[model samples]
Target chain A: MQRYFVNADPSAEITLPSEAAHHLLKVMRAGIGTKVELVLADHCVYLATVSVTEPAAKLKIIQKLLSNSELPVSVTLACGIPKTKEKPELIVQKSTELGADKIVFFEAARSISHWQGSKQKRKIERLQKIAESAAEQSHRNKIPLVEYCKSLDALISDYPATKRVVAWEESAKQGETSALAHQFNGLQAGDSMLAVFGPEGGLTETEITKMNNAGIEAVGLGPRILRTETAPLYFMAAISYAMELS
Target chain B: MQRYFVNADPSAEITLPSEAAHHLLKVMRAGIGTKVELVLADHCVYLATVSVTEPAAKLKIIQKLLSNSELPVSVTLACGIPKTKEKPELIVQKSTELGADKIVFFEAARSISHWQGSKQKRKIERLQKIAESAAEQSHRNKIPLVEYCKSLDALISDYPATKRVVAWEESAKQGETSALAHQFNGLQAGDSMLAVFGPEGGLTETEITKMNNAGIEAVGLGPRILRTETAPLYFMAAISYAMELS
Candidate 1:
């Protein structure tokens, strides 16, 4: 069954937006009485059937399904904006599947690509679409938000969490293995965690120092040196394994 | 400093292979005394310096670095061949970075792309190069081998491990969360683990039943529905977290 995120009252008819309407009617070739899952304004999954498909795509709700796929603790991934276009897209897509609540890209000292002005808005919009699609394909209850942070300092200040950690290769080099597990173990239900990651060249020493000063602990993903795009995905998977599977 | 996998005696002068020589001498513009880490036939990392770059790139071992980046448990990821060209490449690159010992792609019942005859050899060779490069970039002690299997039966029967588990979405739906953790915890040092994952459309019930009859246990990665490419990377990271970090 297809899943769409729509904001509408469950008591009323749900009309998909233009893009989603095109997708359902044209791309998927869904006709009237075609059953699909809709995530309503309350972010709950409901079984719905296509009722009107000519002028606009509309569906009628059957009943609320007792389904919740969100992680128990919300996870926010703050990554340094990578140089290539593909890295951010990969990060948003994979992290959303791994149960990230929000994905933020910040301009670090070593960042080569800067999304500024209108470009920033366009980039975030595109990545947000990718997140929504991935969330639906992964059967997630909610779509992860994609945002942009101007700098590392702003990221640290704007996103306050119950626990915060910066992934540092130096920490792994120093064999500090317990910090990430320690942080995961300390979390309670509904607690939020903000994990910061570096870009291609990785976060500079000054950036690490600044994060260290802000009371954010430096933790290692593991011993192997993961690339900029791979680290946050690793963190997201580790978190899921810790909180969900284990 | 760069890292390369070389097969030579640590007590003698080491000659770089043709590709590594070109990468070090031309691409990286390495000069005399340019230090690099080399993994010898013994699979141990040694600090080496460029002693001669005339006929062939040659280096002298300075000392052993006492570095070990391999996982305590060797992981073999056997995946159903995906349709897109990029999925296999992504799986090879990212899984190597996360410390996979070997990666196998087998033709599942629902596999869209089939690598038959000579195409299979060429594809494996290309993917092998990607694994080697990713291994070097991630500072891994060993490059994960890329292999192709004719069928799922060959994958299950040939590559024997101390433990075997298939990633099944139905297992997750049935609330089988403890199986994966139980398998991970049961693994001891130097034990090998074989994890099987389906392709895009997923494995058929017959395939799952065959594996079940072969005594391979079904395990869930997590609650979310991960794509074929994303599941192996998740397993790699989760294993690293369970065995290496925590």
Candidate 2:
């Protein structure tokens, strides 16, 4: 069954948003009695059926299903805005599939592209849509939010978690292999983690110093030099393997 | 410093391959005395400097550097051919970065796209180039080979490993979480692993049954559903975490 994120309370009849209705009715060609999964506002998956489609596409809730496809510890990936437009899109899509709770693109000292004014809002909206689709495809109960942080300072101040770490390339260069595992070992269920990554040129020394002072320890993904976009996905997967699978 | 994979013995002077020469001379604008890291035929990183740029670029090896950026256990990803062209490219590139030793695409029962005759050779050549570039960017000692197997039987017979597993969605649905870790725990350093994945429609029941009979264990990545391309990368990352990082 196809899944859609519906923003409403559990009721007898539920109307899907316009975009989802268009996808169900026109794109998927779903008709009356077609079954689907709707993730309502409570972040729960509910079995639903297409009941009415004349005025608007409405689904009748059948029953709530016991589905939990989220990470034990919430992960918030704060990335330094990469140079190309496709990097953020790739990060959001892949990280969401890997079970990220939130994705934030922050302006780093070495960042080339800056998300400003209405461009920031438009980009966030587009990325949020990508996250939603990815979440549905991955059968995730929660759709990860996409946001933009104006600077490293704003990111440090805003997203506080039980644990904070920066994916620093120098850490790997210095052979600091155990910091990431150490961080993972300390995480408990329901604890949130904030992982920061740099852009193309990578994070500046001053930025690293500031983050270090703010209690964000620097860790490495592995020995290989990962590109700006690949590091976060690696971190997400490693965390999932450590916490969920292992 | 720029890195290039040169298929030559560790000699005092080494002539760069045509493609690497063009990239070093034209793309990087490297001149005499420019430092570079070359992974010679012995699977070792050598510090080299540009010695000649006339006719063909040449480099003089200074000294061998101690570097090992590979997973402790060798990993071979055997994926069922994906539908779109981009998914294979993405899988090849990302898996190479994540330390895959080899990547093979086999025709699955549900595969929509088929690679035949010269088309197969051409597609493999293009994907091999992608793997090479990704390997260099990730500073890998060995460039992972990109291959196409005609069928699943061919994949099973051609590449024998110490451990063989398949990423099956049914295993995840059934909550088989410990199987992957169990496989990883059984692996020793220098041991090779073959991980198989299905395509868009996924592997047929017959294919799964055949693998099971062959003693290839079915392992679940996690509760979330990964796309045909995402599952192999997830397996690669998980193995690296289990064997290399943790």
Candidate 3:
């Protein structure tokens, strides 16, 4: 069954958006009486039957499905803006599928790409589309938000979690093995975490010092090196395994 | 430092291949005394210095780096061939970076894309290139091999591991919380695991039955529904966290 994320409350009757309506009626060829999953603003999954498909897609509530596949602990990934455009797109799409609550692209000392005034909104819009589609495909309860930060300073000051850490290369180089797992082990349900990653070149000493001052601990992913985009996905998976699967 | 994979003996000093030489000298623009890391056929990282950079790049070994980033347990990922061409390439590239030893593409019952005679070989070659590049970029000791199986039957009969498991949706649907982490926890050093995943449409009931009969355990990744490519990366990261980092 096709799924759509709507901004209306679950109890309210709402028409599907234009893009979603086209997808349901034309792309999916959903007909009258076709059942689909709808995620309303309340983040509840409801089964709705298609009432009308001619003018625009309309649905009537059938029954609520008892389905919840979200992570117990919400994860907000704070990544340094990478050198290329494709990296951020890939990060948002894949991370949304892996159950991220939010993704913020912050400019680091080594960051080569910068999102200026108008370009920032357009970039976030494009990435948010990717996140929305990925959320639908993955059957997520909430669509992850994609935003940009002008600098690491702004990102560190804005986002605060129960636990905060950076994926530091020096940590791995110095053989800091249990820090990541230890932090993850202490997380409880409803707790959120913010993980910081570097760009293509990697995080500098000054950046590490700043994070240290902000009370963000440095954690190593593993012995092997991971690319800028790969590190966040690694963190997502590790967090899921530790908090949800373990 | 630049890294390259050479299929030469560990003790022997081998000349860099033409392609690798061009990449080192022309693309990277390395100096005559530039130091680089090379992975030999023995899967050992060796520190080598450029002896000559005139026409072709030449390097002489100095000493072994004594750095090993491989997972304690050998991993063989048996993934169903995904629909798009880019997905398999992405899986191979990312999994190689995450330290997968081998990657096999099998034809699942729900697979949309089929690899024919010449197409299979071409796909394997293309994915092999991706794995090689990713291995070098991630500073891996070995390049993960990319291969294909004709059917699920062939995949089951061919590869045997100390422990065999399938990433089943039912396990995730039932919310089997401890299955994946327990499986990882039970693994010992040098133990090899073969993990199977479904295609886009997912594995059928009959296929699951067949694997269960073959002593392959079915385990869920997490609560959320992961895409065909995302699931395997999650498995890789979890394994790294459990065996490498923890």
Candidate 4:
């Protein structure tokens, strides 16, 4: 069944939103009596069936499902805005599927591209849409929010979590393998984590020192050198494996 | 320093391949005495210096560096060919960075597109180049091979391994969380693993039965519904985390 995020409270009938209605009626070609899944504002999945069509599309709620696909620990991925537009899109789409609570793009000391003024807003909005579509496609209960920060200072001050770490290539080069596993060991259910990644050229030593001063430990993903965009996805998958599977 | 994979054995003087020579001498603008890392055919990293660049660029091997980025267990990813060209390319590139040893594309019952005749040869060759480039970019010692198989039966018969698992959505829907973990627990160092992933529409019942009969186990990556391209990547990252980190 197709899934869509809805904002309204649970009721006997739901008048589908204009965009979702068009997608269901036209794109998916769903007719009256077609079944679909709606994730309400409460982050709960509800089964619904189309009951009315002509003037407006309406769905009758069948029942609420016992599904819970969200990760146990909330994860926020803060990345330095990469050089190319496609990198952020790939990061948002893949990380959403891997179960992220939020994604933040901040300009770092080594950042080459600046997301300024209206471009920042448009980029975040576009990435937010990508997250929403990916969440629906992955059957996620929550859609992750996409945000931007002007500087690493803003990202560090704004998105504090129970545990914080940065994906540092230097750590990998130094053969520091267990720091990430150690961080995962300390996480509890409902705890939040913030993982920061560098841009293409990588984080500067001064930036690393600042983050270290702020109590953000540096950890390596593994031995291989993952690209800036690949690092966050690897982190997400590793998190899922640690918390969900094992 | 930039890294390149070479096909020659370690010698006092080694001539760089035309492509690697072009990248070093032209693209990178390297003069004599420029230092770079080279991975020889023995899957070892050697620090080398540019010696001559007139007729053919040659490097003088300085010393061997103690570095290994390969997974403890060899992994072979056999995927049902997806519809889009970008998917196979993404899988090849990302999985190479994630430490896959080999990648095979096979036609499944629900596959919308087919790879036949000269097109198949060209597609596999292009994907192979992608894997090689990704390996170099990730600073890996070995480049993963990309090949194509005709069917699931050929995939099973041709690629035997110490353990095998298929990423099945039904297993995920049924809340089979620990199967993948159990499989990872059984893998030993130097052991080989083969993981199969379905295409967009997923594997048919008949294909699943054939694999089951062949002693391949079905395992769920996690609770989330990952796309065809995303599933192999999740598998790769999970394996890396299991063997390398925790």
> What are the iRMS values of all candidates?
0.6, 0.8, 0.9, 0.6
RMSD to the hidden true structure, all candidates: 0.9, 0.9, 1.2, 1.0
Taking the tens digit of each residue's C-alpha lDDT, what string does model 3 give over B27-133? 99887888999999888999999998766667899989988989989999999999999899889999998999999999899899999899999999989999988
lDDT value for model 3: 0.90
Give the docking tier of candidate 2: medium
What does DockQ give for each predicted structure? Answer: 0.91, 0.79, 0.86, 0.90
Ranking of candidates on lDDT, top first: 4, 1, 2, 3
Tens-digit lDDT track for model 4 on B102-176?
A: 999999988888999999999999999999899999989999999999998899899999999999999999989
Which ranges in model 3 have alpha carbons more than 4 Å from their true place?
Answer: none
User: What DockQ would candidate 4 receive versus the native complex?
Assistant: 0.90
DockQ of 2: 0.79
Clashes of each: 0, 0, 0, 0
* Kept native contacts, fraction for each prediction: 0.89, 0.65, 0.89, 0.84
User: Which pairs, if any, clash in model 2?
Assistant: none
Error of 2 at A105 (Å): 0.3
lDDT of 1: 0.93
Residue B44, candidate 1: Cα error in Å is 0.6
**Candidate 2 positional error at A178, Å:** 1.1
TM-score of each: 0.99, 0.99, 0.98, 0.99
Question: Candidate 2: where are CA atoms >4 Å away?
Answer: none
| Whole-model lDDT per candidate | 0.93, 0.93, 0.90, 0.94
